[model samples]
Target: MNKKWRWTIGISSVVIVLVVLTIIKIGTTQGAKPDWYSAWASAASSLIALIALVAAAVAANATIQTNKTQTRQLAKLEETQQSDRASKFAVWRALHPTRDSQIYRTFFHNAGPLPMYDVIIHYFVNGHEYTSKEETLPPTSTPELVKKSDNNLEWFIKKLAIEEYGLYQPKTKEEVAAIADLKKRAEAENVRIELVRAINEGKNRYVKDIRIETGVSFSDGENTWYRAPNGRLERTS
Candidate 1:
């Protein structure tokens, strides 16, 4: 038999043996044996039974306590993982300034005009740099920029929420002039330029996935938030 069943049978045997010994002693004391031996035998059987019962109770309680400890430990581990994920989300939100890129991203998911946003240069290809520029989809405006790019794989975005993603604005003549003046004063960093277009809702529905497409440099897996050249949430790619 199994170890547990063996233990149970052994304990039962011990109890039965004690009871039989007690009965025999009682009978002998009334006839052949002395009264003192009978009394001692009865006391011994009672003590053994009490000890066995106490041991069994302790064993059962110990098993229950161990199970409870394991359950609590697992719960604590899950809570810690959830807390870590939440902290990461907060960090990303602080770093990525979506509002500075465009006003629509700052307020609501506008389905009209695209908001201008910023992004760091992922890298330069030839003379152009790849960046995740901020783009917006303003409400009431036709999101033709994205729709017409259906043939263009590079311009495809999964979903475009109004005011959700940011937009990128081009460098103005004044800004370029400022850059020239700054070069005469001191050589500043060269900024990359990119185009951002707004997307329409339900226009090109597909597999039901919308990704943040600032340009070639966009990384949805990035933990960091992007910023624009104008010190806004949006940046040119």
Candidate 2:
């Protein structure tokens, strides 16, 4: 089964055959009976020994070659495992964007109407993820204080857009639901609205998310703005 035993067995068989033939040769050629038959037998024994030695050498070489192939295969398997782990990590980071560490800044309103804009914060959301798109903020105050009595809700929404109009980013049908959800959350919390919406308002493709501007809209058609982690103001894309 093992190389050592296989070599021993092959070598012993060859030596035993040669020894037997040599002993017979010496006996037959002792005296008055010089048998020529013993010489041919001795030659045959030598040929058998040479064949067995070649077989042992071939078996050893095959074993070494097999080990080499297995080692190479094992190394490749480890490399593939490492690569798979790294790819999964990249995908997760892309999705969440906000993992660990302080990587972003934002602003929002706390509560109440015109005379108070309580808290204007600049803090990090999630450092792990980057924006898939931009989000807009809620209006600063509700229509409860407005003078319009007809269709109070719509009036209030329009007023909020005009007065604190800084928070609105035009919405596609799909984004409308998310905006509504944000409004509901803002009412329930009774605090400043926090919105990070994606936009394509400019030539900058990298500006995917914009924080609310609190109370400012651009001149013609641009109103969205990006707040970097250090509070640098940027025109939205």
Candidate 3:
């Protein structure tokens, strides 16, 4: 089963055959074997030994090549695993409502070790898709805040509360109904969001399994940004 045992068996078989042939030659010549017969048998034994050596060399070379291939495959697998581990990103949201003012401050946080780039949070409302403006969210140690009202919710609230005269005031019955319907649509849809980062060579990384309540729409003159998942801002790609 092993190389040593196989070599031992092959060599023993060859030696046994040589001894048997020698004995036969010597017997047929009545204990005085012809020189040519001995020479032919020696040549045959040498040829067999050479064949065994070549076979062993071939087997050893094949084994070495196989080991090299396996080593390279293992190294590649480890590299892929390390890349996955280092590139993982997670998005988190926290609601910090001020008790006195009833100002609902919703903070979107990046919870992973890696920095997230072009982190567009996508939300679904009544089967329609909306996305947050592409932004970079640094790692957990350096949290970024999103002013929900200024950036997102207040627009809807203002359009509803303000009359045609443009004075800011409380919402009328119809406005209240519209706001309630919007809230219902948002909650009913559950607003699944995607946080994505695109990189050089068109490679993309996404923060998986996190959901947010709202999505943003980018205006015509918005800025696009990029960053490496593990490091500082990447100015290109």
Leading candidate by lDDT? 3
Report how far off residue 84 is in candidate 3 (Å). 4.8
Worst 10 residues of 2 by lDDT: 85-94
TM-score of every candidate: 0.27, 0.27, 0.36
Candidate topping TM-score = 3
Clashes of 3: 2
Q: What is the C-alpha lDDT of each candidate?
A: 0.39, 0.39, 0.47
Score residue 118 of candidate 1 by CA lDDT.
27
Q: In model 3, what lDDT does residue 155 have?
A: 43
User: Whole-model lDDT for model 2 versus the true structure?
Assistant: 0.39
Per-residue lDDT of candidate 1, residues 3-95 (tens digit): 586478568767867676767667765856677676767776786777678667666766777788899999888755433322221101112
C-alpha positional error of residue 119 in candidate 3 after TM-score superposition, expressed in Å: 2.5
What 10-residue stretch in candidate 1 is worst by lDDT? 86-95
- Clash totals, every prediction: 36, 16, 2
Give the better candidate number (2 or 3) by lDDT: 3
